[model samples]
Target: MTPVLYLDFDGVLHPADVRVTASEPKRPRVYNGGSTNHPLLEHAPLLERILAPFADVKIVLSTSWVRVLGYEYTMQQLPAALRERVVGTIWQGELLQHPPRTRYDAIQSDANNRGVTRWLALDDDTEGWPDEQRYALIAPNNFWYGLAQPGVADELSQALALLCAGKPLESRLPQETHVPSTVERIFGLG
Candidate 1:
């Protein structure tokens, strides 16, 4: 099976706190249908750099952008090269009143339905993920910069390398350790 990279956009591609007003008095911006006009869109290349080497890696959108912008437009927002790597999306237009308790549950539901065993989720929210799957997630401690933070992309790449090498989900790499501090573990900064 091809390894899937479950990707989120708001916090993963750019700053989650970036505010957008309906009226922009400052500058004339190229507006897509949705809020893909992030200043950090320039960081697309950084994501590409890490993902490029893993030819077997396929992308699966776990971002809400897919629902708002439409699948085709959301795919266009990504770099042209990465567009082809996109195989599918996690959300399928379901309007659940009470959505899955956490992002991990939603991703796992999709993964389970798709029969995807080899996969890693890159998201900012790390709530409710069990330790087994937590190792597979390369969550950003810094929401503003996401993977652009120093060493984050490298760590993500390394994790992908291990996954692509056929390592089981339960296997822990040398760099990975159980966080002793309660705060770090709770926030998934471990």
Candidate 2:
């Protein structure tokens, strides 16, 4: 079975709160408050670097960008290396006519249709993902950091290694650690 990675653009490659102007629908801009002002796909190089050694791994677009911007336009946004790895997209033709409820559902349906037994998803949306299949999801929960978040690249690399090795993906996402406000920190209450 060919190893597949379901890639999300909004929250995986860049910040989740991205906006595209009516005049420039193809150009996506990030609006993640004032936390982190990362350019679109600012972490693309990191992702590209991680996947460089795994030449056989294929990518499947599971992002809403493909639905909103069209497949070709969305594909153009990726760097050459990542773009070349894209085998297909989840939002096209029949799937577009009848879209899935959640990202996980779309990927699951696509994987089953393609007979892909070894696959994982790099996404931030965890709404409909079940606990049993959580092992296949590498979630960069912080919208501001996305793939740049600490340990996310490592998690993705490790997952890809496991997938290529034909090993069961059993790693769960690390528990979130809370960062206290400055006030709490100063008062030693955190």
Best by lDDT: 2
Clashing pairs in 1: none
Task: Please name the candidate that would achieve the greatest TM-score relative to the true structure.
Answer: 2
Q: What is the lDDT of residue 35 in candidate 2?
A: 31
- After aligning candidate 2 to the native by TM-score, how far in Å is the CA of 73 from where it should be? 0.5
Regions more than 4 Å wrong, model 2: 33-37, 171-190
Model 2's TM-score against the true structure: 0.86
TM of each candidate vs. truth: 0.77, 0.86
Q: For model 2, how does the per-residue alpha-carbon lDDT over 6-74 read when each residue is reduced to its tens digit?
A: 999887788799887888777678875633456888889999999998999999999999888899988
Error of 1 at 101 (Å): 2.5
- Count clashing residue pairs in model 1: 0
Q: After superposition, how far is residue 55 of candidate 2 from its true place, in Å?
A: 0.9
